[model samples]
Target: MMKTMKILTALAATMATIPAVAHEIWVERDASGPARIYLGEPAEAVPEAGDPEFHHLQKPQAIQSDDKPIAFVRRANHIEATVPGSGDVRVRDDSVFAPWKSGEKMQGAIFYARAGRSETAAKLDLELVPAAANADRFTLLFRGKPVPAAKLTVITPDRWQKAFFTDANGGVEIPKLGAGRYIVGASHTEEGPAKLGGQDVASVVHISTLTFVR
Candidate 1:
């Protein structure tokens, strides 16, 4: 009975350490600091329906792009870019608190093959080079869904870049993309072509749409 009791005690101690490995935001400074929480007050706690202070807090500056869509720039997060045509773009989400961190790099790619090739879907590999460690985060949206298409990897020598159809199989040959069309676009969570609140922020190349065909 003593031996069994000892084993059970050891197991309990090991299980106690699991919570430390999970990082969490807190409101207090104690070891088990106040956990980060979202506002969920009742409607009565909100100010008057049309109060100026309340409205101002919720209003977001709208941006415009002549014929292109605005990429999202996580509000309240900071990022920089050296590309001239790039400006602070719009993130595609409208959540109260966007989860992307500042300096996260963003990119996308599209593969195209001949209309009737035996291997129409090709596999490709690309590297992303960021200016700093943890400097950028990558979010890839393909056909409107987030997939492994990104090949998540450690930051490589060529971070902050993109490539398409890079495999050695005949599937990669340009001929395989028999005269068909494809669309690909990319944007940075931190950078943009226009200054915040500027009239022309939306038209920047922050949201780049590319069309390729054989």
Candidate 2:
């Protein structure tokens, strides 16, 4: 029992380093229709933006509106891109690498986005999206492939949180939800070390997020 407790304690500590809402990027449309990229929890009263500490990767790249290139402007807290007419707009941030601890390395801060009813893959280290329009099922991908048994945390419009895991096909079924906004997040840590933050550390933790309105 003591050994089990120790393992659980260590797991908790590791998770503490990655906040429940950190490392997630999603698109939000203002009243006028222009899309803004936000970096934190979309469910927050005022979801935070940007990751100056860990966003050592290059600026957002491959920003597009239905395959047509769109320019992105960096703001104090978030990145903004104009949506052209919206069929399936997608954007991704540069991947950043950093030392998780002594001898462990991790790369992350990757983000992907698309608007409404479209189930496209961002093809990042990890990706999340709804299965279909008004669907309660979601799919997760790792390195552009299905991530079976991946764990996820889902936040509803009212801030209710639930824990779930992907099935054999990297899919998760969520409870029937009301219309507002939602955020689903997942993460994975690998044993191999990658060069990040100018040094070599231990393992790499990859985080992904998907946000949409019903």
Candidate 3:
């Protein structure tokens, strides 16, 4: 089961903009592949009327810096990113706004993930022992699309109760991604579903660096 605890708003704001300072940034799997360029927000707020990029985004001006990607992926909202220094920033809808409130400075994962090649997907099995009873629902996000539904399973502690998830594609399973390092895990949050903070006891399981192959 997952619990919702409010982190201090002051901290969240600080950790949201760490990716703006980078010399060179690009998401890479190995060598030859397409990596998205993370364009950052301006240092000082550019006038909304004068700024051409402002009106295009849901929340402009507040976008993090173009500093090298604190994390990397081909596209946005396809995978979860882990910010190394302070904390983490979860990407929800390919959004440009930071995941923090005003005045709240935070240090966590402040990177974003996006779909790359077909090789970025993988199969994962998680053993969830929640702090309390939960709805027993979670999502396996790879890049942005769900993994093969047949590959996901939720097993109860009793060893008898088991449930299988279904992909939108009738009986056919979702795509089995190619070979690459993918940040794989489960999330319940709708906005920042893959964004994880604090302890591992929460509803999400950010197990390891997932790599798929031929």
Error of 1 at 22 (Å): 31
Model 3 agreement with the true structure over 1-214: per-residue lDDT tens digits: 1232235453465555443322111122333332223232212223423333332233111122345454442233222243333211222222333333323332222223222223222232211111122212223453344444534322121222223454553122223233323222222222223443332211222221111112
- Expressed as tens digits, the lDDT of each residue in 65-175 for candidate 1 is 444532322222111111113222221212222122122322221111111111211121111211232222222333333334322211111222234432222111122
Q: Candidate 2 residues 30-125, lDDT tens each?
A: 334666666655555542545544244346564443466666777756667766674444456534333444324343333565444365545456
Minimum summed lDDT over a 10-residue window in model 1 is located at 21-30
Model 1 per-residue lDDT at 51? 23
Q: Root-mean-square deviation of each candidate, in angstroms? A: 20.3, 6.6, 17.0
Worst 10 residues of 2 by lDDT: 101-110
Cα lDDT, all candidates: 0.24, 0.62, 0.28
Q: Order of all candidates by TM-score, from best down to worst? A: 2, 3, 1
lDDT of 1 at 88: 20
Ten-residue stretch with the least lDDT total in model 3: 205-214
Count of backbone clashes, every candidate in sequence = 26, 7, 33
